[model samples]
Target: MQLRLQQRLQERRQQSLYRQRLTLSSPQGAEVQIGTERLLCFCSNDYLGLANHPQVITSLQENAARYGVGSGASHLVVGHSGPHQELEEALAEFTGRPRALLFSSGYMANIGIMAALLKRGDAVFEDRLNHASLLDGGLLSGARLQRFRHNDTDHLKQLLQQRADVEGKLVATDGVFSMDGDSAPLGELATVCAEQGALLVVDDAHGFGVLGANGAGSLEQAGLSAREVPVLMGTLGKALGTGGAFVAGDEDLIEGLIQFARSYIYTTAIPPALVAATLVSLELLTTEAWRRPHLQQLIARFRAGAEQLGLPLMDSQSPIQPLLVGDADAALRLSEKLRSDGVLVSAIRPPTVHAGTARLRITLSAAHNEDQVDRLLDALQRHA
Candidate 1:
């Protein structure tokens, strides 16, 4: 077994697909400390930049003193506290849903939702570019999983037509493709689901707390209601700059998951103090209106500058920007060069993206100023 594992590891390294982690010695922000180097960061998912907000930190500290550190038990056990219930209510109200049920993380939320709702004979349809968690959820649900071409509504329509005899049909998609940074055509997918008598589930981990007028996510931005998109899964760790995730829908859906979702039933709840911090972060998410527009402006500025530099840019209106580089080694080289220039961007290689579509997954945060964006562009111009 050791020999086999070593061979597989060697293969990954030879292909330039080995994964590594960066050690951050400072809090999350536009700039972060690694070792003795201070890097202008562009790979964090803290889009609204509330992760290190003073109010958020104070709320966490206060709540930690009040509730202590750990949840101690699962939500179905004695662990669900005042903050948990309050945050659920606030999230439901924010998403305009009948109820919201929290999960320990976005991956668990997606997995539990699929397992609770699907069984044998049910058919699950997913976009080819949906997040790995969503795809894994469908695969693990004991249902027939079908992946349609990425964002191709026509292909999805045909797949649904072919599987018309299946009574329980589910369509899952990422509200925002994580690697490519392109948004799912939510409006189109919702319409397709309605026509095909299938349920639509959106994992809006990247879109929530960043898009929309009230930061209610891609659904609100697309003018979609809870009825149109039945299952909405979002993460607090991203734009909300907290932790955990939730599924917002009608009361029946939340109740069903509570009763049947094993992941939710068995796993310990997130810390009540963290939830308290999240509540404060959620308020700041909607109230601090400047964050969203400032983030959008940064995205626009980066894209325009990249275009002028003849960079290989993808069509993404969100904060995630990908500069496509065909070879994995080339992508890594570009990332290393940017790091040497005092900027931090992640090289997204195969498995995260396609074989020939390796890219630098550059993310923008509202905490960043115009100068920081220019600094990133300057580094890219020198290295990319």
Candidate 2:
């Protein structure tokens, strides 16, 4: 069996499908040291560049000195501390939600939300291009999971009509799609879900720190209220530069999740220090309006340059900008070409993306200036 596994791995390598990590010797920022080359990295999910922000780092250090290290227990077993509680309140208010509950990660939060609200007879309608985590949550809930055409509201309504007899029908989507870098048709989806008596769940993992007034996320951008999109799940990992996620909803949903969500109740609580860092990140994400505005400018600049170079950019204004490279081998070659020119935009290939749509994911952050964006464009232009 071991030999067969090794042979299969070799076959992947031959097919240009083997994946490996690029080691970074420094903190995550616009510029990073990959091996000996200092490249302008454009592949991080850190949109607001809070991952290495000085204030957030200071808050973590100060809180860790006071709180020691780990929580040492699950939240339900007396590990929930003042910092965690404070952060939850802050999250709820920031999201315009009545209550919120924290879990260890976005993956866990989705699983917990679905499993707690849905049972064997329940049904879930989801976008075909939603994050894999959401799909896993539906699968784990033992619900009848149905996939609608990507961002196609008509298909969603058709599925909901088909499953009208189900005890529970929840429609879920990603605010900003992970690989494709497009947003869901939120307003249309919300209307359909509302009339069909299906609850809407929006996972704003990539949108939380980058969109709307004061960066309140996709729901805010679309002007949707809690009553319209009932369950909102957003992460602190991408823009907040922390580890954990929260599900924001009304009092009843939050209370029920606390009682029944196994992922929230059974997992060890995140460290108080990490929560502190996240709180500081949230402050920056909310109050500092320039970060979001500056990132938008950078995105526009990059898009304009990519178009002039005839690159296959996606139809998105968010930080995630993907250039479709078609073949896995072609995507890898383009990434290598960029690396050679001291730019690091990662190639995302099959399995992570759909087959035949492997791409170069070029992410923009506030930590990057216009010069860096120009430098990346120059590198791509040179290759083109």
Candidate 3:
């Protein structure tokens, strides 16, 4: 087994698909310290730039002092605290849902939702480019998982038609595609779900706190209501700049999940102090409307610059801007070159993306100034 594992690892290295973690010596922001070097970072999911916000930090510290670090047990046991309950109430109100249940992470939320809602002979339709967690959830649910073309609602409609005979039908997709940085056709998908009598599940992990007028998420941005897209999941670790995730829906749905979702039932609840921080972040996400526009400005600047450089850029309006490099080795080389030029961006290779679509996953944050964006552009132009 060890020899086989070694051979597989060697194969990955040879194929330029081996992954590595950068040790950050400083807090997450537009600029980060890795070892002795400080690089202008364009690879974090801190879209609203609240990860290191002073207010958020203060809230966390104060709540930690009160809550005493850990929750001590699962939510059913003793973990659920005042902050957790308040956060859930806030999330439910923000998303315009009857109730919201928190989970330890986005993965656990997806898995628990699917496990509780789906079962044998059920049909779960997904987008080809859906996140790994959603796909894994469908598989673990013992459902017939069918993936249609990415963002192709017509194909999804056709699949739903074919599966019309299947009584238990659920359609799952990412509100925003993580790798490609494009949004799902929520309006069209909702229409298809309505016609097919399927439940629409949207994992807005990337879109929450980044899109919409009030930063409610992609559903709101796309003019979708709770009736149109029932199961809504969002994470605090992304645009909210904290940790944990939640699922929002009607009272019955949430009540059912509370009783049957094993992941939520068995796992320890997220730290109450972190939830306090998230509450502060959530307030900022809504009240500080300037952050989203500034992020858009930076995204537009980056996109325009990348386009002028004749780089292979995806059609993305979000902070996540991927530049297709085609080959894993070339992507890795480009990332290395950018790092050497005092820039930090991640090279996304196969398994994370399609085989020939390896690229640099450039993420922008509101914490970045225009000059910082220019620095990234200069680095890319110099290395390209």
Candidate 4:
């Protein structure tokens, strides 16, 4: 068994499908010292650049000093602290929902919502390109999972129509497609779900701190409401530059999750200090409109430059911009060339992306300036 497992892993490496980690010598920012090289990177999801903000770090330190580390138990136990409660309330308000529930990670939150709200006889519809966690949750829910074409609401509607004979239906999608770097057709999707009498779950992982007037997320960006879209899941990791994730909806939805979401109920809670840090990040993410606009400027700068160069850029208004290089080897080669040029952008290959559509997943951040964007463009132009 061990030999077979090792052989299969080696097959991944042979195909350039293996992923490796790089150690950062400092906090996430525009540039980082990876080993000995100070590479200008365009791969971090720290959209507003609050990962290293003084206020967030100071809050974490102060809270940790008072509360110490690990949450020590689950929220159902004695571990649910004041900071967690306050952050949850703030996030609920930010999302324009009646209530919100936090989980250790986006994956856990996705799993919890799907498993709690769905069951064997119900129908679950998902966008094919949704985050792996959402797909996993759909599968685990035993909800007769049927995936539509990426962002194809018509296809989703057709599937839901077919499944009208079933018990109930839940239609889930990533508000921002993870690898493709595109937005789901939320306006159409919301209407489809409403007409079909199905619940819509929007995982706004990539939109939480970058989209909408107040940076609420893609739901708000689409002018949708809790009554319209229902279940909303967003992460603190990407734009908020913190850890953990949450699901927000009505009071009933939250209370239902509390009673039945296995992922939330059984697991140990995340650290209280991390929650404190996230609270600070939430404040900055909400109040500092400049960071969001600056990030938009960076995205515009990067995209316009890439377009002028005729690079294969995807249709994305968000920070995640991918250049779809057809083969895994080609994507890896392009990434290596960029890295050698002292610019860092990760080569995204299957199964992170679809097998044939390997690419460089270039994520912009507020930490980067126009010059850095130009530097990346220069490298890409040469290699592309």
Q: Which ten residues in a row have the lowest lDDT in candidate 4?
A: 280-289
Question: Which residue ranges in model 3 land beyond 4 Å of their true spot?
Answer: none
Writing each residue's lDDT as its tens digit, candidate 2 over 310-351 gives: 988989999999988899999999999988888898989878
- Residue-by-residue lDDT tens digits, candidate 4, 271-315: 999999999999987577799899899899989899899998989
Positional deviation of residue 160's Cα in model 1 after best superposition, in angstroms: 0.7
Candidate 1 residue-wise lDDT, 43-151, digit = tens: 9999999999999999999999999999999998899999999999999999999899999999999999999999999999999999998999999999999999999
CA lDDT scores, all candidates in order: 0.95, 0.92, 0.94, 0.91
TM-score of each: 0.99, 0.98, 0.99, 0.99
Error of 2 at 156 (Å): 0.8
Indicate the residue-level lDDT of 151 in model 3: 88
Distance from true position, residue 71, model 1, in Å? Answer: 0.4
TM-score of 2: 0.98
Off by over 4 Å in 4: none
Q: Which candidate order results from sorting by lDDT in descending order? A: 1, 3, 2, 4
Query: Over the stretch 117-217, how does candidate 3's per-residue lDDT look in tens digits?
Result: 99999999999999999999999999999999998889999999998889999999999899999999899899889999999999999999999988888
* lDDT score, candidate 1: 0.95
